[model samples]
Target: MKKDIEIPKVEDISVAVVKEWNDEKTEEVFNVYLINLQNKQIQNTLVTSKGYGENQSTGEKINTSVLRHFIGDLDAKDFAKIEPIIEEVFGLNNEYWVSFFQNNQMYDKKFIFLPETICDENMINVPLLNKKGVVI
Candidate 1:
């Protein structure tokens, strides 16, 4: 006899730029990660920049384009329940700094927000990054 199993409802989700490192002098990139508080899962994505040049004298340069969108969804009550956990995971306060990008341009891209239908399945290489915030 098989016993019925109950699945826990997902409470909250969040995305944050975890770290940025210099891959090459002309090519720096960022590592972004998504977190599911209810499930304690993480997904990491890499992003890069366009032009390559250094500033005179100061010797600093812009290595990457801004990441416009990072978004997620969860049950309202769940969000409240895990708000502290989400903040700790992302190391963010009420106002966090994020790179901004333009919308609808060739550079514009969108992140994926797992729909209710597939929230229970693993989403790999889902093209979950874009100019706008996460897309459901």
Candidate 2:
């Protein structure tokens, strides 16, 4: 029965890891952002993120604490800062599960950044934010 349920596809929205100047404007910091590129607005947005991976040297499994953020509403062609990400977790799998309602319909999707996928080699000009980072 689960397969019979209709699940609408989430489109035009993206999660990006951005590199930005620190508050003092001295150094750069990495942050996560939720971008909504739809033609309409989304409400009651909830985003949860976590990181997990294996240590190459010790072969140890690693997992970070899950953080949940509630973004009340997001306007069309806009973006909201989800959280600040420490560079140490760049070697892990960063996963973000986002849920929101648009036009009275609910939408959900999982956006993930694989280990080391946030490197400079994969950086791009993220829309709306206009910053350099990897988008999922």
Candidate 3:
């Protein structure tokens, strides 16, 4: 009989450049933050835009948007705690996605639990799977 395996919660956070036009004329910037649900601590990350486009008004200039990526580990409980805050900050229609790891590969799947509740330090070095089965 297959036993029910419990999956720990985890969240991966990232910030992408949403807009970029005419590098010389205007530059877009993105600020990414990671909030600790338990303590409400926040970490700020900044990303500059980069892209290639023509600035017709300026005659000659390149337009670009630079995307920045940030990944944070949070357990299920903690994630739930701050889900509302995250949603409010990022809002709807943003480019945000979650992934799961299996056999050394990341799979696109929404985790059911908050990432802050999981114990990251203990599982950092451990492989996603082992001889028995998947490790949460």
Candidate 4:
């Protein structure tokens, strides 16, 4: 019975972590965004993000507070800013669990940025955001 459920695959959706200059703050900052690349809209979008990992030097396990964002809807080829991320958590494993509706069906996926994966070396010109960052 458990295997009878239809779980449609999630495609054309992405989560990007962007590093950009915040003119008002006079410093660079990290921000998260939810991108919809499907031919249709994404409705009732919800994203939950958190960071967790062990400190390399201190050997202490670290876990950041989990934050939930309700983005509502994202039009085709459009995107929505999810949250602002602090650079301090870059050393941890950052994860974003995303769920939404498309074509009246529910789909979800989990994206993880491994430790130190958000560095400048891995940055790319992210779509829609027009800034350099990592996307997973």
Q: Write down the worst ten-residue block by lDDT for model 2.
A: 112-121
Q: Top TM-score: which candidate number?
A: 2
TM-score rank order: 2, 4, 3, 1
Stretches off by above 4 angstroms in model 4 are none
Candidate 1 pairs with clashing backbones: 69-133, 109-130, 109-131, 110-129, 110-130, 111-128
> What is each predicted model's overall lDDT from 0 to 1?
0.29, 0.95, 0.29, 0.91
Residue pairs with clashing backbones, model 4: none
Q: 38-73, model 4: which lDDT tens digit per residue?
A: 889989999999999999999999999999999998
Candidate 3 local lDDT, 10-126, one digit each (tens):
433322122222347475332222222233322222222223334446756453233444333443223211111222222222222344343344434221212222222322222
For model 3, what is the error of residue 36's alpha carbon versus the real structure, in angstroms, after optimal superposition?
14
What residue pairs are clashing in model 2? none
lDDT ranking from best to worst? 2, 4, 1, 3
Query: Per-residue lDDT for 56 in model 4?
Result: 94
Give one digit per residue, the lDDT tens place, for model 1 in 1-136.
2457543322244443322234565642334444334343222222221222454567675333433233423222222111111212221112222222222211212333221212213333322233222212
Give candidate 2's error at residue 123 in angstroms.
0.8
C-alpha lDDT of residue 107 in model 1 = 22
Candidate 3 error regions (>4 Å): 1-3, 11-22, 25-92, 100-136
